[model samples]
Target chain A: MKKGMGTITAPWKQLLLNALESNSHLKHSSYFQLATVGCNGRPSNRTLVFRGFQESSDKFHINTDNRTLKIEELKHCPFAEICWYFTDSWEQFRISGRVDIIDGSNPDTFKLQQREKSWFASSVKSRLQYLGPNPGLPRISEHQSEEEVRLDPSIGPVAAFCLLVLDPDQVDYLNLKNNERVKFISTLDVNGVKNWTSERINP
Target chain B: MKKGMGTITAPWKQLLLNALESNSHLKHSSYFQLATVGCNGRPSNRTLVFRGFQESSDKFHINTDNRTLKIEELKHCPFAEICWYFTDSWEQFRISGRVDIIDGSNPDTFKLQQREKSWFASSVKSRLQYLGPNPGLPRISEHQSEEEVRLDPSIGPVAAFCLLVLDPDQVDYLNLKNNERVKFISTLDVNGVKNWTSERINP
Candidate 1:
């Protein structure tokens, strides 16, 4: 097992990492738009914070509340696409792949460990978000929600705190400078080995 | 016919207008993520510049190159979604609905007039994007593509200039500060009368 993205290097992954490094000055650079097919059969889109790369692998990490509509949408369709735009470099990366939701009920124990790692890795302020009232529900009176939360950080992840991992199969990289574009594709062989191929295309 | 949104108004529309007004200082605020169902039965996502509201109505205007993959994807399925996030206000609006592509071949004369209006409304640099080599094709070398284009400004929009109109049926608005959310839904009756209903939802 590669165990990490250490030896499993790809040109696009390095390029993405470089883009993130260059654009780290802007706080919004970590934000991306995630698109999924909703349960209603319509395309649904939302903004999500990129948690980071997951365990040194090509997969991306994103934390979400299990109770959110995206959870249900992912259940209906696991395939999703995310568009990340780097303002400083004038580059856009559109990654399309399958999303695996690792929640409390996930049968894989190792995956659950990663969930807990992500939970504790979050700041106290971020962890408090998962302890609050469910998202997308009618807002309670401001006074009521202002009360202090009693979530214990050492107790592991709360029920609502879930980790989402996007295993990308295709990447469309576009740079506005000089109108450059590239497409990176990942294919799995019969033995379940993944291979990456990249091509430079017109912008 | 209500040719414009002059007499028609909705709470969500007003809120969206306010969000845009407050965030206009950011150049990237005008950019949003648009997602469409690809012909391959997967979700396709990309970043696009928002032209503005169509006429004075609620429909959003977006310009695209007719040669892009989205043009073919739209033909396969017209449903699409857009996610716009405001940094200053920390608000997100997810708009989902059917898209109507108005290109050179569109039969609607009124829409063609709108297309022309959009063409002239764009700056010279913006107009040049459509005059280049076909997007997504293999690059033919930097020297050849570096040659100046001979596009005539007064000749109007080129064949590849296309205008996309998204008449939204649903808007999911979320404000992260106080964890407030609202759902706005539009339904059309048998008599072709459209009605909008809004509800405060959990955040």
Candidate 2:
């Protein structure tokens, strides 16, 4: 077992961080599933792609379109839990957190830099609501092609309604092997400091 | 848009069913993150695996250790939405549902079929307890080896406690593409019939 600075020092934590850092697949496509309670008190969940994480700031960022039901609900209630897990590895990170929509400056510059030209163009074009199959409908271009679209300027409106910043409240780490299953529970204080403890329970 | 069976078109409904059916990677995982509300009214999510799904019954099942916090709170509140999304396809499914503990003969059969051989061995060896590191302590074995442990009829006690079943109330399908986004919502009525509708949404 290795000791770490995050108030939780266990083998699993180190393993988790290593997995997150070393696995490009996890970084590339890990979707943060956000869960929120609807007006009727039922739970709701939506997938938000994992954008970036600032360890020093202890904040994670994700991009979302402004019109999602999740965004609408978050306006009414900002509390949510974000979850990510790797299918190949029996490891999962569940973050319970409060969400805030960040509409300042141009965060899309960062997102644009991370994406390929094709992906960025596709994303913008798709934003026009033209991908679905509708019989006898005229087609119109919604976005500029890769060569014509300018990143610096394109970042403005995209960033205007793009990023979601989550300040996690608690995190649960679970690892399951053939015989052993390990779990760690880490609760975050109001200041976003984590206090973690471990418990082994029946699998 | 094409119109057919019970509010949802045959093509779209087929797409929804195929998305869930063809995804073997999603099915084999041991745990899935379930988002719920904590006692403090904060969002909480934890990983639990896909147990089984009954097409005939239109129900999904997942199992968890009896001692987890979510299980305790779930007894008080059964409303939750389960989210599962595949990274490669960016395909997402959100199931709004009610949770109930499965017991009796059906649950017993489900447990035996769903649990891997290693899981049974771990339970037999001991109730795994999470203890902080003790210097020079002997390593405890959760299971001797996979082959050494056989399914004992005596293990029925532990088997009875961990089954959970979710009956979906509504399912939202989000298919994100480069040019447009397609959204489908399906609600299950009291008589266990499903009604679905689709609309194009701005991404």
Instruction: Identify the candidate with maximal TM-score.
Output: 1
Docking class of 1: medium
**Residue A114 lDDT, candidate 2, scale 0-100:** 29
**Each model's RMSD to truth, in Å?**
2.0, 8.7
CAPRI class assigned to model 2: acceptable
Per-residue CA lDDT of model 1 for A46-136, tens digit only, reads 9999988877578889999998999999988999999998878999999999999999999988789889989998887888888777787
Report how far residue A93 has shifted in candidate 2, in Å: 1.1
Interface RMSD of 2: 8.7
Fold similarity of candidate 2's chain A to the true chain A, as a TM-score: 0.60
lDDT (tens digit, per residue) of candidate 2 on B47-98: 5666555434545666555556776667667877777665545566666677
Q: How big is the positional error of residue A133 in model 1, measured in Å on the Cα after superposition?
A: 2.6
**Model 2 residue A134 CA deviation in Å:** 18
After superposition, candidate 1 runs with Cα above 4 Å error: A1-7, A140-142, B2-6, B189-191
